[model samples]
Target: MQSFRTELENPIVERDIIELEQKIRLFREGKIPDEKFRSLRLARGVYGQRQPGVQMVRIKLPYGKMTLAQWKRISDISDEFSTGNLHLTTRQDIQVHFVSLDRTPELWSQLEQDDITIREACGNTVRNITASDAAGIDPDEPFDVTPYADAAFRYFLRNPICQDMGRKFKMSFSSSDKDTAFAYMHDVGVIPKIQLIDGKEVRGFKVMIAGGLGAQPQLAKVAFEFLPADQLIPYIESVLRVFDRHGERSSRHKARMKFLVQKIGMEAFEELVKEEFTAVKNKVVPIDADAWIATEPSETPGALPAYTIENPQQFEQWKKTNVFEQKQAGFFGAYVRVLLGNISSDISRLLIEKLQPVIADDVRVTVNQGLLLKFIRGEHLAYVYSQLEAVGLAAPGFNSVADITACPGTDTCNLGISSSTGIAVALEQVIQEEYPGLIYNTDIKIKISGCMNSCGQHGMANIGFHGSSMKSKGKVLPALQVLLGGGTMGNGAGRVADKVLKVPSKRGPDVLRSVLNDYATNLQEGELFNDYYDRRGERYFYDLLKPLADLTTLQDEDFIDWGQANDFATAIGVGECAGVVIDLIATLLYEAEEKLLLATESITAGAYADAIYHAYSCFVQSAKALLLDDGVSCNTQISIINDFEKHFEETRRFPVSNFKDMVLEINKQEPSAAFAEQYFQQAKEFYKASQQYRANKTAQTVNA
Candidate 1:
C-alpha cells in the first residue's frame, strides 16, 4: 500500500508544480544554474490575486476560525510580506490574496511556527468547515455551536479521508435555527438541538448530510436529530470515510456526496455512518473548545465611536438596509459591504489601515461576502462611518432590494454563461425605482452568478438569477434562468428554487421588471415578494415572462438597451459599483391581493386618533418627500392622506387599510398584516435604535 505522502507527489496539483520542484532540486545540485528561483516562483500560482507589481500569495485558511497567532500571524504576514488585504471568503476561509511568491516558503514557515498550512486552499478537497456567520453572536441561538464547528474543522483539516475526495465538500454548523451558514447547500450540515432525558437540555446536534446544489441540487437528509456535540467529529469522520471509499469515481459531476446520499437511502447511509463513527470514536481525545470560540463578541478598542444622532433620516434608511442587530448590548454589527467583494490593492491596504485605527486589535472577515469590523467603541461609530465615506465606500443600498451578490464569470473563467455582474446592476437599478418605498422598509437579499457554479449562491436568495445561454437569431447569447422562492437563516424552511424560464441577457431587466410589476399588481396586500412568488407557483411567473423571453434576438436591440452588444457585466466578481437606478423598476409588477398601501392614511374617527394622527402625519410627510423624490409626482392620487384630519370622527382605532385586497378594499386593517408585519415592525425598532447609526454617518460626513 502506498503511504499518504507518496499519494501527494503526483500531477493533480497542476503539472507545473512537479516541473518547478525538479528545477529547484537541479539548481541546488548545480545541474541548473542557481539564478532561476525568482522567475520560477511567479509562475507556480504563487503570486498575488491582483496588484500588477506587488505579489501577495493567498495562503488559505480553510475554515474561518484560526488560532490566536494564526490569526495574528496573518496580520503579521500581511504587515511583513506584502500589502495587508487579508479577506474571509464566503466559503468560510481566509484569503491573503496579495503576497510575494519569492517569500512563499517564508510565509509557510511563519505559519508553520503557528501550526497553519495553506496546502488545501484552492484544489479539490473539503475546503472549509462553514458555520453560522454569526455562530456565537445571535442571542436567540439554541446553543453556541462554534465548538463543534471548530472540532470538525480540526478533525478533518488534513485527514486522509478528506484529501482528494471525488469532488469538493462543504460542511457547515447551523448553530441557530436560522441556518444562515447555508447548511442546506453543503455536503454536510450540523445544527444544535436539545435532547431531553428527564426534561433536561442535553447537548447534541441534528445532523443533516449531503445537501448541495449547482447544476443539480439536493437538500440533505436528517441522519440524527440529537447526537452529542462531542460525538460530531467522529461521526462526521465516519461519513467522510464512507464517502471516500464509496463515492462515484467514474464521473466528476456525479461524484459529490449529495449524489452518493441519493444513491443510498437515508436509513442505509445512517447505518453506515454509525458503524464508521463507532470505529473511530475512541481514537481521538475529547477536544477542549474553551480555547477556541468562547462567546459572542463584545465591544473592544478601535471600533467606530458612538454619537447621538437626533434624527438620521438618510442614515436611518441606510442602517435599515445594511446594519444588523448583534447579540451584544449597547453595541451593533455592521456588514462592511465590499462592492462585489473585490478588494483593490490600494483599497485592501486602506481597509487594513483605516480599520486598524477604529476597530479593536482583532478584525474578522465574514462569509456573507462582507467584512465584520468588530469591537467598536460605543461612541466612535460615527468616526468610522466618516472614515469609510471619505474613502468612497459609503452606500445607502447595503441589503436593499438592490444589494446584490454575483459570481466572477467569463473574463476570468471559461464556464461562465452570462455577465452576472451586468445583470445584477441592471436588476438593482430597475427595482429601486419601481418599488422605492416598498424596498426601503424591508430587507430582501438578491444574489446572482454568471454560471451554475453557484458562487454567488443564487440558491439562497428570495429572488435569484443564474447565467445561461440561449439561442437567439441562430447565435447563442448570454441569458439568465430565473430562480424564485429560496432563502435561509432565521427565515422560512429552506426550499430548492424552481427555475422559471430563460431571459436573454439584454431582456433580463425586462423579465425582472415584468415580475415586479406583477408583484405590485397581485401581492396579497402585505406579502413580501418571495411568499408571493412561492404561493403563486411557477406558472404565473412563466406566463408573465412569456412576452420578454420571446423577444430574444441576436440583433441586440431587443435585449439590453444600456449595453454595447453582447457585453454585460453580470459575470461573477466583475465589480458592479453603480448604475442601479433604472434596471429594477423595469422588471416584475404585482398582480394579486394587489393594492399599494396608502403611504398616508385618512383615519380620524377613532379612540387612538392621536396615535393614528401621528402615524398619518408621519406617513404624509414621508410620502410627500418620498413620492416627490421618486419622480412619481405625475400620479396625483399617490397621496390619499393629503387631507388627513386632526379631527377624531372618521378613522378606525387601527386606522390602516388592508393593502392586500385586490378589490382595493378601504376596510380598516391592522398594519400587522403586511410584510412579516412583526419583522417589519422589529426592523423599524432596530432602525429606531440606529439613532447612533444615523448620527455617526452625519459625523462621518462632517469630518470628511
Candidate 2:
C-alpha cells in the first residue's frame, strides 16, 4: 500500500484516506481484529464480496448528481483499480466491484480529485441521500428539493452522532406528489409541498418516518403532513438521536427504524423524538436553493452538428420512452438505460464526450438505475438519441418493464444466494422480444435481488423477484421468490409486494410470460397491475403459476444456477451490512477506552450530545466486556445492562450500585456540558473498575 499524504487537496479527506490505509495495513498485519476492521472499512465503503480477496467500493453520489468530470474520474478509477465496470445502485450511488481492498485508499483519493466521495456510503451510518432524478426539471414539482437533500447529506456526512449507529439509515426526497423518489419506503422520506398561509406561499415537506424493506417490509408513518422546510434538518437530527439511543442492536433484521417504530407505536416514538429536540444543535436549518441551482456547462458546442438517424423508428421509440419534457420550455430530460445498471468504463467516457454538446452539466442518476440527462434542446433530442445509440446506450423503456432493476447478486455481493443479474437479463429479453409493446409501459416495474435484502428495491416493484433456492431429491436448485401487486400509490403512499410464490430460477422468464399473458388476456380496461392483483388476490396468481413450480419436470441443468458452470450450491457468506460481532474481550476494552477519549474530545469541541453518547458507549462497552468475562454473552446494549445487574451488580462481585439506572442516566439527563463531563467521569470510573476486576478474576483462575 502507498501513502496519500499530500495527494488530496482536502486535508480532511486526505487524512481519512490515510487513516483507512493505516487501518488496512494494521488489519493485514493481524494487529486489528476482523470484526473491528470490517466495521472500519465498511464505513469507508470498502465492502467484502462473496469472492475472497476482493472488495466492492460504493461511491456516494449525493442526490445522485455528478458532473461529467466526476463521472470520467470514476470511470478512470474503475478502469485502473476495479473490474472496469460501474454498477449503478437503486439508491443512486455507483459501485465498482472486484477491486483489491489494499488499493481502496488510492482509488478513494483519485475519486476525491473530482469532488466525488465514498464516505458513509455503507455500514451503520446514513447511506446516500436520494432524491427524484428529475428534481429541478420536473414539470409537476412544486419546487426542487435538491438543496434540502444536499443539506441533509452534508450535515450528516461526518456527524459524530451517526458515525456508529445500530444500523444503516436511509432517506429520500420526492420532487412532486408523483412520489418518483418513493419517499414512503425509507427511514426518513420527504416529499416537497407548498402551503398557502395568509396569501403567502410557504415551502414545506410531507415527512414520513420508519419505513424500510428487507426480508420484512414496513410502510413509513406520516410524521407530519406539512413540516416547514426550515425545520427539516432539526427534525431529522432529533429522529436520528432517538433512533441511535433506543433502536435494536442485537438482531440485524430488527435493527432498522421500522422495527423500532413498530415495537413502540408512532406516538411513543414521536415522544422520544420530541425529547431529543433540546439536544439537537440546530433548531432550524434554512436551505438556500440558489446555492445549488442548476447551471449550464461553461463549455458547450457552439453549433449543433448535422446528424442522420439510421434507424428512424427506433429513434422515435427511444424518444417516446426515454425522453421527458422538462419544466423549462423546449428543454428535455433524456434517460439513458444501461442494462442491469452495469456500464463499461469505455462507454461511460464516450457518453461524457458525446453528450457534452447538448446536455446540461448536471447529470442526475435515476433511482431505477439509469442516467437522467437534463436541459437537452427539442431539436437535439434526435442528436442525443443518435449519440447514445452509437454508444449502445439508447435503450428505450428507461423505467419501463424492459429495463429490469437488479443487484449484483452472486457476481459480487456476499449475501447473494443466486444470480440476480443473470435472471434479470433473461427477464429483460422476455420483455424486449416477446412483450415488445410493454416497452412504453412505465406502470409495471420488474426488479430482482440476489437475496431477500431489497438492495435492488424489489419490495416496491409491481412485479418483484428475490433470489432463493429449493431442495428436491437431495439436490439444491436455484429459485426466485416471486412477488406481486406492490408499487407507488402516489402522495407518499406505497405498497410492499406480497410474496406470491417461489419458482425455479431458470423459469424466471416463463414466470414473467405467464403473468403478462394472464394480465393481457383477462385484464379489464384502465386497471393497473396492483388493482388487478387486488381484485384477483394472491391465490389466483399462485394457482395460475403453480405448474411452473413442479419439481417432477426438472432437468439435470435445473440443478445449475445462472451464470455458473457448476451445479447449484448455497454459498452464502456472513453479511457485513451490520458489523460482525467481536467476542474478544481485549478489543471491547480497547474500544471502550477509545470511546472515552472521543468523549473528552467531543466535550472540548462543544458537541454536548456527541460527547454524552460517546460516554454512554464507553459505559456499555466496558460493562459488556466485564460481563463477557463471566461467560455471560449478551446481544443488545439494553440487555447487557440488565444481565450485568443480575450477574455482577446483584452479587456484589463488581463495584456498582443500581447498574441499570447508572447506564440509563444518559437518556434521562439533559445533554449539557455539566452532564457530559459528569457522564465522562462515570464512564471512566466504570472502565477502570471493570479492568481491575477482570485482572483479579484472571489471577484467581490462574491460581486454581
In terms of lDDT, the best-performing candidate is 2
Give candidate 2 regions above 4 Å deviation. 1-4, 297-300, 641-675
User: Candidate 2's residue-wise lDDT over 70-154, tens digit each?
Assistant: 8999999999998789998899999998899888998898899999999999899999999999988899999989989989999
Q: Residues 142-212, candidate 1: write the lDDT tens digits.
A: 76677777666666654544544445677877757767676667777877777787887677777777888
Q: What CA RMSD would candidate 1 show?
A: 28.4
- Each model's TM-score, in the order given? 0.66, 0.95
**lDDT for predicted candidate 1 compared with the true structure:** 0.54
Question: Which regions of candidate 1 are displaced past 4 Å?
Answer: 1-59, 62-88, 94-117, 198-200, 281-287, 291-312, 431-443, 489-492, 552-554, 557-704
Deviation (Å) of 374 in candidate 2:
0.9
Considering summed lDDT, which 10 consecutive residues are worst modelled in model 1?
586-595
